[model samples]
Target: MPVVLQAGSFGRIRLIYVLVQYVDETPKFGHTAVDSSSGTPILNSSAAGVSPPTPAFTPSHYSHIYGSTPETLTTIDAPKNYGHAPWPRISPREACLLRYFIEELSRWFDLTDPHNNFATSIPQRARSNPILLDAILAASARHFSTLPSDQKAHIMSHYGLSPLPSHIHDSNSELSITEETVIHYHSRCIAELRVLANEPHAVMDEDLLAAVVVLRFFEELDNPFTSPPTETALHGLHVFLRAQASSALLVPGPRQASFWIGFRQEFNLAFSQQRNTNLPLEITDSYLIFTGAEDHVWTNRLVVLGARVLEFSYGSSPSNDLEFNELVRLRDEWVDKRPRSFAPIYTESPDMDTAFPKIWYTDDSHITAAQTLLLINILLLAYSPSIPRIGPSRRQTLESIDAQIRTIVLEICGMALSNRQSRPAGLTACIAINLCADRFTDPQEQRALMGLVVGTTRDSNYWPTKEAERRLRGIWGWDGDDD
Candidate 1:
């Protein structure tokens, strides 16, 4: 007998308690475990007659407003050879969402990796993996809902996101096919994840991990002050990452990609909340050793270093001179030993039109690394422990710190403004602006900073800048009515 829990149209979850004689039983699915970095079998936890043994790491409690599973979004049978079957038939709206994902959203995930797995491999995998497809659809639909109305119509027609029911629009007004589509796919994915959470072996699936990572991004877009924080997606991420860390060796595929993406997400949250990141530093230290790796790997090394700087500034540990000196040493070493590719392709002083110097890089990775480096420097300077000094010397130290922070903020603005295509660079610039926006007292400089912040949201469409702008105005003591 099974106990069934029902909610609404989302469907029901049945909990069947089985009395097993053996505790240390192996999974009924045969074969010894191997690295899943290369193409591997994605287990179908939903399939019948497969009772997997209890996993070593259990999933955390996942509570969401949406309950139960919806109808299967795809017809592809699981536990089959991926890349062999034809793509499932999709509606025009789904097609448009997928196109939007490839053109816009994919770039966000593939920022660190030059290979662009999210852009190239993940989309292809989603065709066969329903969970991943649902996650992608959810994220794409949420992003589409955030765009300005005028641009939304243009994009919808361009990608054929049409033929929606006339009654879809409700009193909420923003609740069109876009928002409903997000909930539709998101709830379905959550229901599927709820099923998979019971099966321990499913946690090691790279595609499954990638699906959660994508959902985390969707949660970020859904956040923007309008909605309450639902850390359920983040908790799901911790569960999968912990399970992967405990059970399987971290390989260089989707799991690795998810790790980096998760780090960026965690970094943003930690920075904003002024708390240490939940991710372990030891795990991050193992990757990106910078021993003659590619330019992207080198940039990744700087990202790891930036995390250390962040921890130093916000972690519970008391700041010590030894750690501070070591951080400075590491920053200098990276600057000295980095490949020539990191050098800016061109540099121009601030002209009549621009307040910040224009700096350009040959590749997106270079500019991103440069932005991170500037941020690292800013944090170190701002949070450096004070030393005993005479009256005039104390004033001098304050001026020096102010000057350094101002310079870095300007450079970050310049990098973001110059390379408009690189969203990651713009994101890093946003962090810099958030931290040091008050340093700019001049009205013209303030407007320029606000433009970069506002422009990032306008260009990216995913990151909500309204709240950020509001915070900045409060800090600067400007009237709320003015933009």
Candidate 2:
């Protein structure tokens, strides 16, 4: 006879077992039941023709058979082109972006307020702000990984992130690294410095330090792989140093000198090492002074320096052999006409007519040749390696010229700052006047010349005292003012 298990309970015999043990093996057996109380089989129906007792279906049967409920199955179907490239690595651009974001955020915490440095600002805050920093790092790495190796390297170099040390490993577990990774690391350094700078309770001196750090980083950006820095980097460093030295920190003594010397040395090295022959003269001068030891080179350097000093003091170009002479002649002529006041350095000769032609009479007639010479002299004075010679008489003259130049530059700066009416031509004229002051030697004479350039009467908006004071402070030097 066949047997059946009770409903909602696991039985010794299931459908397959029942078929195997009874129907398949013993065809003569009909319906049968297995009693739960006793492990014994009981006939319920006869033979194959009779029906067996119905059994109830319950959760326990399925539970024992299949275990627990099956969880919702999930699988990611990546696109067909998904494996084209390996997972992206961190990049320099992303690093820079991350740094920028963090520094900007830190600004909100009043980092500049000397009383609140980073520690005091958030005493309980965790070290490194890992959460934010990691997010930035991950995002940057992903974005940069999409770019080509060379492009990534270039950007990394720009951010000072390339040529990373062996310790900064990537996923391949390989020690070999790409330039882009180094650049990203550099950006991280910058961002870290920026955070420090932004910390409240930062000392006044820290501001200067921050400026120096930024300048140094920029200098590094010019060339990443090479030890020698580029001209662009040198120029940028000089500009920053000049500005910083002139700021409230007053970096004038040995510190300033040391910075300049280092700058000059690096600049020279770059010039000498450069493969390009068509490098600029200024860059060449920068290199030669450091690498070459010839007396003649020193002489040339002195001359250049002297010329620059004179230009800054007098607002006149002494290097222009022709214009220098013409300027002297013009000054003499003007002195002769108005002996009471100093002669104008520049004047129009009604007798001569050419494109922007004006005879600049100097102590000598040869100084009035070409405008190009004048322009060149001006450029040299503005960006020269030489220093000026000072004597009581010359110093007095320089002071006068500097004052006049300051007055003019301040006016132009003010105009630009105001964002007022269109004053493009006026600003250009002001810059030209400043260049003239940079080249000239006699302060009184330069002022007079500047007056002539500005057409005698001063503008109503021109407040000389306040403007001069502001500019002097901006330049971080009191020497410009005659007072």
Candidate 3:
């Protein structure tokens, strides 16, 4: 098997590895076949039994990817030490939202962690931490508010029926969540946080870190795709992160997990507005050293690389040849040194109906890492500081850049569309679409891209994609009714 790197034609680095035969089996997250042109789900169902375990690769094979001796590989040994806390009492309706979070919404946060502590550990911690509990409830309630009536009924049906709050209802007499309803939980979280903020060690508290991260999701839901916020009320998030960085609290566990999620969130805001992120690089760099052995550690490396790219793109310092070359080298090293597990399990070229190819990974971590790699390439290509060329040379350089970008963007979309079982995959697709949707002038291809964005927003109920769709249509000069 040869892995193709999409930096450019001259930049392609092929990795030689043993080809594992493709087995036609149920995907781990089940399968959802999408209509590429319309982003419509053609079939959505789960299969019994787990996917067969991945074929084991030898230690020597792993060494080839890690660029070190087998003995040098450090296994991640973080203790799960989430001690017990007294479970809190809540009304029957809040109970339904809590269950909804465990069953459905936690996947959004845990998409890249196989251990899934958001579903397992965060809820456990929330039992005793009212701030954390309120943040989770607020995020869950906002997500729940987006569901269609029938789907909400289906989800509510699983949890025992509970009486809806009178205030939650609209004039239509049907069940509807008011803005005040979500804010009720959100404001409670912030107000309590104000008291905790006065304490010297509050930033060092991992539970508080996780709560703030959860609230960031709620902030995203409220102002999806908004500008680099200046006057937003959630300003305390940056203060906590900066203070926490100094307190040396970014150790490996829930704190590190929240760090990665917070980094990604900060990255999204920075990229959207062409501004530098407030996340401290020295703190994040400690985790990106690539010394650990967990799958999430590898994913976090790509996450950090994204931040470095953004810094180079939008930082106030003048660009120098050394900085540009270093960024390029880091990106190249990451692609060449990724573990074998990051390789796609299956691949198929795009057919007549689809705008992108079908490349599938084994699980959420692999999917996220692959998509992040594509995103890094897109950023590098978009912000490359290559010297100016004149006449035909300039035109040639422009064409080459556009080709590389389209190639990377298509792969990004392919990964997301193929792995729709993971919710964050679709969100990644929306991010790419927002970045490069205008590059394509072809009508059919544009429609397919729009379908993926709009379809993902519809299916996932992630409001960011809805905002992304509006921006894309505006960029393409598409009327609201145009397909």
Across 1-483, the per-residue lDDT of candidate 1 in tens digits comes to: 122222211112222112122122222222332111112233332332344343332111112323533234134332322233223424445567777899888988887777788988888787667678879988998888787776777776676455334535442232244554666567656655554545646766788878878988887775642233344566656655655653322455666777678766766666655556666666666543557877877877787787788888887653677888888888988898899989988899897777888888878778878887887787788777664356768878878888888888888889888887777677777777877777778777888888888887788875688788888888777895664
Query: Model 2 lDDT vs. the true structure?
Result: 0.32
lDDT of each: 0.67, 0.32, 0.67
Q: Using TM-score, rank the candidates from best to worst.
A: 3, 1, 2
lDDT of 3 by residue, 192-275 (tens): 554453466566677877887787787677666644473332344565566566443334567666766777777767776667
Off by over 4 Å in 1: 1-86, 156-176, 224-230, 245-250, 287-289, 386-392, 480-483
**Worst 10-residue lDDT window, candidate 3:** 7-16
For candidate 2, write residues 75-193 as lDDT tens digits.
32222322232112212333354543343322222212223222232211112232223333333333344344555456556656653443454532221233444333333333333
> What lDDT is reached at residue 169 by model 1?
48
Give residue 23's lDDT in candidate 2 (0 to 100).
Answer: 25
Question: Distance from true position, residue 152, model 3, in Å?
Answer: 0.8
Candidate 2, TM-score vs. the true structure?
Answer: 0.21
Q: lDDT at 105 for candidate 1?
A: 88
Which is the winner by TM-score between candidate 1 and candidate 2? Answer: 1
lDDT of 3: 0.67
Mark the 10 consecutive residues where model 2 has the least summed lDDT.
Answer: 9-18
